[model samples]
Target: MLIFLQERRLPLSLCGWQMRNRLIYLPISSITEWFAIPMVNLRVISLAAPFVLCTSLFALSLVQAQSLPTKKKSDISAPAPQAKTVSLSNIPHAVATAFCETYPNAALVSATWVERNAETCIKLHTSEGTKTRDLLYRLSGELIEMAETISPIALPEAVKETIHEEFSRAEILSAKRLVSAAPTLYEVTLSFGAEKETLIYDAKGVLVRKVEHLPRAVQKAFEAQYPRAEILAFSKQDEDGFVRWVIESREGQSHREIVYAETGEVVAISERLFPIDLPEAIKETLAESFSGSTLITAKRLTQVQYHISVSDSSGNTMLALDATGKLLDMDAQSEHVLLSLATSPAPSQDLKAEEDAIAPIPVALPDPEVDLAVALKPIKVEEPLAAIAAEKKERPVIIVRRYYAPSLGWIPPIMRLWRPSWWW
Candidate 1:
């Protein structure tokens, strides 16, 4: 047991009970005599004692180890790297040189060191005129990626041509360029009437992505409502968490804009109108209340109301009227105007046409048969009445016939009933 204990290098406390009883070092004969046990049983107990003590010690140690606190794998892991701001002068020579060479006109705003794809990189913010640019570069002075805000006029000819070809009437709102991209790219925002769209294109002017489309429900509703309307542009918008679709269309010379809800219900509509297109009631109302007022602009909303801007001697004023030509909201002045309009009778169509008609001018007919001698001949009162009557009957009477002109209604003919001695 002792030899086994020494080889195992177990502590003496493992067999403390045996030591307290003074049985650990006792001989087998003494053990048997003291306990009055048989020699064979004593030998067996002595050999098994160390084994049992060692087993108990191992079990106790394992239980104690399990009860203690230990660190978790996540707690010992390394932290992630974060970006750190740095000054331009602190940047490496290669990085600074490359940036200056690439953007000589750019003014630096900020610089930072960031980890990208497990490699250190430098990020730069720069400005040129009103535009701003962001660039990412490697420590080896190689450009990784760059994005720059630009004006619409700075776009390449190819890109401009592509946009014009696709949307001839579209107005560009903003433009952005991305350098060092896989194929380079440009992002453009355009406005068509009240609608807006964003289009992405490659450097070669090829369209890469377009994200403007109406919902199926909205498309169906608009098509059903305005089957003959030529759609110029359409866009989707989210207002205060509510989604809507806006469309601009044209029907002949008139333009219209419409808004629709996600469920395909119309929210609002505005249609542009010419002065000549105003309703008869509206024209009469304007003539009576705002005479001599030149119309600046006119629009009808949902066919329920008319909003018109007019300019007169007093300056411009906007008026809102209903379909029946009644003011929507009337003040004291407006009430007076309305009362005057109500009291006065509108001119009839025929009267207005006659007042606008142009006056006719009569022209004289030429006579080619009368000779100079006959024209110069004088009438003699002493000559016989029958001879004078015969001479007058032989002469050609100047009868001017007037005809109706398409533009002018009719012209009266002039009759030459009397002639001077020199005019035959």
Candidate 2:
């Protein structure tokens, strides 16, 4: 610290130092009394006078300039926290405007707010026909990515071939394509026995990774229940904590979906049974009605209802039946089901050729703004639209009951003479 001694008029020799300037270099420790300028005893002042000097010529440069160093540039690795979700009304005008300008017709199914690397993003789920697309946008309303559902069959030939060769026994249950700033990849879920495996494949069809595993007990139970049936597919029902296993035995026609609890207990069972699984009574009833006929296939609609397709020398016939093995008339509305199955071609015996041509069916893509109400809807909720036209041709049967007058069996003499073969 620098301080000026108070005895300015004193001669330098009397002050004990002949300094050019009356400044003193005192250690911060000895400067308590010098904080306030005051008259000091000459004897006391003179004792410290020998240290005086001009600060500008000496101490000024000794005081080092100190400040915090500029903070290092931010790390690219630390991702930003996710953005908070807000109501549609809370969306920024710029973002909303950009979205509207880009996808004017998008039918919004849902939306969410997310942040990546400090950038505010709006993720939207827009329904287009039977497909839903996920759209990502920046705060400025710039479209970042537009990812829609893509059928596995629509994947590049290389990708499909790779999957088929690698998992030939595994059937693809669902697939989706993600197109972002990076290279495109397909996410596919395949069913192998009771296990569902998910894999990511590059555009060229290289496998990237697998997803997860299930309880061994659950898998064992599924295999046990459907010993002969090939595992068609499987999915987890998170809401109920149950796993659904789709099993099929006869080509791809017979299907059975069994839901098992996490503990391996049966939760529910719904199977599409073939003709061979029909109750004895039901089989006998069909035999009596359509003699010398072969059962081609049978679809069990419920515990009691069945749609039986039989082929006789004349042609194929469809029979509706109840659980008690009694014939039931098809409902007027369900008449189309019979008509469709009747006209549908029977499965070709050349399974190898049919299997070779298996392809993924793509969902119809519609404009974002199009209304789903105007889209073609299935008249039968239980029937898949894709297979309806195919099923219509080969499985034909409309059993219309023919009512006959009771007196015709023992026709009155007068009526017998006039009765024609068709009339009687």
Candidate 3:
């Protein structure tokens, strides 16, 4: 056995396995050579070899498992919470009771359930009088926040006094109140003549901050386009989740309103135009198409379209035209006004001129003395009475013309004496 062990190069110091610092290379032939020893020794080596091999494999697997990468607790993410729309009836009793107690006059517009952190919350949209409100509350009846729209008149007396004292000439446009803040907060939008701004205030009506101003980008863009324009009004509006800025301004005598995106991009423009400001083509079209009509209002929309309102003997008309003076549409308040004037009854002739041209000639009154002399001397008859009568019957009689003159009032009829042919 010792010779075989020596040939196989097996270390005789197996009892010092724990103290061995270097790796030991065990070949398959070394184990096979164990069978060459006595049968009793072979059995003992076989059993021990299998056990040691299994133990080594198990230890290798454990080391590999420990060396593998593991994710930190912070790196793991929880699923996002979702909000669900629900009816007022479906809301928790506690939440509803809390909302009613807080906003007794508010009418529910909508209610929704949302999961936040691990707790369930309720959101409500409500309206009170002319004001609209949004509220959030936890399931346990704890109020989270409340935002409400309010009019200028609804501002607290302290806030109103502050604004009046600070900005005496400013007109309040809108007011909003946030109840979530520790001291509560008020946001007030005001206009000082043409300029507008938003201001924030605390519950005590102390001015906190100014929240709005003409953005630098917008100011640069506007100045580049209208260098000499005076800003009339500046306001911000939100439409469909997009923010827009509106600027009303005037350059010389021209008034214009421009809409701009948040990025200072011009979206649209509206310009107020006087009749004299219109293009030559437009003026000519208006003169030819709507003769004798009064131009009420004219506006240029986006430099492309023109809107004009005109009034005439027939009725009022609204005209939509393009920049080239081409009429796109025309709407008349009265349908008869739309008809061509040529189809109407012909205008009456001037009767006053005709009457002046053929005015009745005034007959000269004979002298009273000459009439007396004629009456005294006319006794001679040219023929028998029957001949004179027959001659008078053959003569034509003259008829007098009469007319009414409003300016001259009524005129008396003119009388004339008839001279017989026999007397002549």
Give per-model CA RMSD.
Answer: 48.2, 41.2, 46.6
Best by lDDT: 1
- Give me candidate 3's TM-score against the actual structure: 0.27
Model 2 lDDT tens row, 59-140: 6545543343445555543335433422445455676787668667656644545434656466666655556577788766
| Candidate 1 error regions (>4 Å) | 1-86, 90-93, 112-118, 192-196, 210-424
Question: In model 1, what are the clashing residue pairs, if there are any?
Answer: none
Top candidate, metric TM-score = 2
Tens digits of per-residue lDDT, candidate 3, 1-424, equal 2223232334456424432334556654655564455545755665477679989999999999999999886466532333333345656778888877888877776554433455656667777656778787887888888878886787889999999999999998789998973778999999988888989998688999887677788888899999999775578767546676778776654667787766777766877676787999999999899999977446787634467888799987888754333455444423545576657876557866676689447899986655767667857566788888999999999999999545412332221122235531
Model 1 lDDT per residue over 265-299, tens place? 77768776778899999999999999988664567
The true-versus-predicted C-alpha distance at residue 38 of model 2, in Å, is: 99
Report lDDT (Cα) of residue 239, candidate 2: 38
Q: lDDT values of the candidates?
A: 0.73, 0.63, 0.71
TM-score for every candidate vs. truth?
Answer: 0.27, 0.29, 0.27
Better of 1 and 2 by TM-score: 2
- Give candidate 3's root-mean-square deviation (CA, Å): 46.6
- The alpha-carbon lDDT assigned to residue 183 of candidate 3 equals 75
